[model samples]
Target chain A: MNETADTMNVPRSRAWTLFGVFAFVALIAAQVHAVLTSPADRDMGHLQKILYVHVPAAWIMSLAFLVVFVFSIRYMWRGQEKDDLLAAAAAEVGATFNGLTLVLGMIWGKPAWGAWWVWDPRVTTTLVLFMIFVGYLALRSFVDDPERRAQWSAAVGAFGAINVPIVYMSVRWWRTLHQIQSSPSTMDSAYVLGLRTNAIAFMLIMIYFIRRRYELARLRRATELIADAAALGGT
Target chain B: MNAESSLAVDAQRIARRFGARWCLRGVSLQVRPGEVVGLAGANGSGKTTFLRVLSTLLKPNAGAARVYGHDVTRAADDVRRHVGFLAHTAGLYDDLTALENLRFAAEMLGRSPEGLEASLDRVGLARVANDRVRGFSAGMQRRLALARLMLMHPRLLLLDEPYANLDAAGIDIMNAVITEVRNAGGAALLVLHELAPAAGMLDRVLTLVDGRIAAEGDGPAANAPTASAPTLASAAGAR
Candidate 1:
């Protein structure tokens, strides 16, 4: 019962330090292994190397959104402030990765598709998903009431998550310019190992970023509670 | 503990801090069923903060507070179920009509809106029951909030400056409702700047200075024009 107050009081700086070292080492190693071992495609050549960053970024973005959706549902159902904190943290990180994915895709497209932008279904839907969560973050900033903010943002977060699946399946559903989903079974073995290693690296960094963001949010909430207490003059 | 002995509010050695300064320090009080306690304090003195902590809107940094035996920190939902909080804001939707606001409160509390009209009439806002709150005057909006509180029938009422923006008739209505709640065996902790008008309604009055209780006495002494009284300062100093 007494544990609720400090439930989010994890050793934040130490964990972040460990994650920073591990992520940097793992990412450098994975990128090196991926570039050196995977042979360039016959048609796309070096342009295919962009897949290691772009595809893994998209995966991490989707994973972050998934965390937002689950945490948002938990927040609404249980009305725990910590759950809302996690949801907000995940949304911010997810939006960053979502933007990164879009930019990387655009960069990859300039070389492979001969253009910087396209109105492909996958690309368009991912843009829309990004906007929804961005709007969620905006709403949190505008609302003053903690409970109201949590309720409204959780609803938006959950709705934004619905678009994630649509974005993932857009290529298959509408026959857009974007290619269909890839899997290790269908890909060349050389590319598969590198892609898998990079995916792990990206996942580690995403988790680290979300945890650090969550810690920052917890500190902010604590400060706000203190200010409220001070203003009211209650013990 | 037996059901009858359960205090409506029980706070012990509660302390709250904002950065380096403390808002409430070692402040403690309790209210039994049928008790109406009026808390008097100057601006920025922490009356509202204390009510907020009791209502479970803010958690204390140290010590504990319970509403009807439910811990404010651990069982906030349980505490909220039995508590009605009238904050500095009316907490009403501007777009919703007075009746709609009461209905929304009822829906949120999972209670039936059986006496919605009666509640409105009690607060003297029945004529404007269907009018949007955005269009209502501050006193009328406060009346609408009071109606919502009456409809909710909470066991513990935490009212922060309930008389703000109220006219004479509105104040009368507010006083009548507070009296009615006490007569029905519920408890209320009212935080107010002026105690003269509410003196008759309160069973006890506590004067807060710099976050701690400076003076405490029965109703009449609280109503005595002590705005600049040396006794209060001396009491605060003696502490």
Candidate 2:
């Protein structure tokens, strides 16, 4: 039993570390480019630089939610417990980035929009989603048995994930306090290239973070099971 | 892997891990058509894990499990179409009435509800079919779950602790159900905590300990009191 836990524990491989390094390097290069070449936005000025991180982080929020959606649906259809865990790990990472997106959006808005926060449709709906997933994760943590936790969490994840689109579509449907989306096609070549590079960098970084987080989650679960067995007097 | 072949089940060195710990390790069991096998184990002895692996709810890390010669890992959808799994909680929606729950499962399994009433009556839940599962007693909930087995008419049945909350009469009803399945030339794996009551229904008994099959032998001793099987007691003590 002791050996079983160790065998299943995911080691942080050198390749994973290297991937992390490359992601950070790419991020720094994009940040440097955004800082050095691009002129201040006529409207937003220096606040635009925050866009490099904030937009990508926001993009990750949805991408991560999508991961939860896919895994949750698969779990429901097939009843695979691991799919539930994968969905849970993705939800945690998504919640982290979603929070970052919210805070960074505020930091940008304080100067440009003259308000620290706004009850815009996108922001409000995303906040609701963040709360829903937060509840999802909380429900998972509160449960003791693995099977029960998986079943309950998968149910919540599948139902809660429906809110992701509501967040994006909220901006389009009713009048919102948030700004309309900036047109991607209208961007200058240089600005677009910078944004694209940073987006890719952020995506790579997001992948690393989610993978590392998943491994950590897996290890933590393993260690906890060992401790539980020990508590039960298993040798 | 052809769905039409009618192979019962073949598990090859199936190992399942939970995080870093093994829930079941290098475990293998086979069941052929018309076999009623009882899986006897103490708590945490990997009985549920083994069932989950067979049901395609959890994949084994290092081996293959197939139902009807359908590889659970690769041909899971096909395997699921043939197997009906019942966990401790019945896996039924608490808010849904018995009929609704059966209807939902029927739709998901692609089984028509044309004979759902017959299934409910077979499980003795037709009288209370309109009640939400939350209002049902444990025995009632279990009966509703068994009704699911009847409605689907699956080729293989996996029951985990199906007798947990049942009274003596309920156990008889359950045994009748298992016997009916066997009579139809289907296979059933019943995970049980005690063998005395349901031992007669099984053709053989397989014991589990520490995530592996500890013993595979004849059905529980008929003349002896079934309570003496210390497997569950030992497991409880281990915990």
* Ten-residue region with minimum lDDT total, candidate 2 chain A: A176-185
Which regions of candidate 1 fall more than 4 Å away from where they truly are? A1-22, A37-40, A70-93, A136-155, A167-190, A207-235, B1-5, B13-27, B52-64, B70-177, B226-228, B231-239
Q: Which 10 successive residues of model 2 chain B have the least lDDT summed?
A: B230-239
Residue B223 CA displacement from its true place in model 1, Å: 2.6
Q: Poorest 10 consecutive residues of model 1 chain B by lDDT?
A: B230-239
Candidate 2 yields a Cα-based lDDT of 0.78
Docking model 1 quality class: incorrect
Across B1-239, the per-residue lDDT of candidate 2 in tens digits comes to 35435658888777666755777767778888899888877778799999998988886766777788888988998898889888877778999999999999889877776777777887778898888888889888888888887776778989988788888877888888888888888999988776666757777778888778887766645214544345444532321
lDDT of each: 0.80, 0.78
Tell me the TM-score of candidate 1's A chain: 0.85
Model 1: colliding residue pairs: A232-B46, A232-B49, A233-B46, A235-B15, A235-B16
Best by DockQ: 1
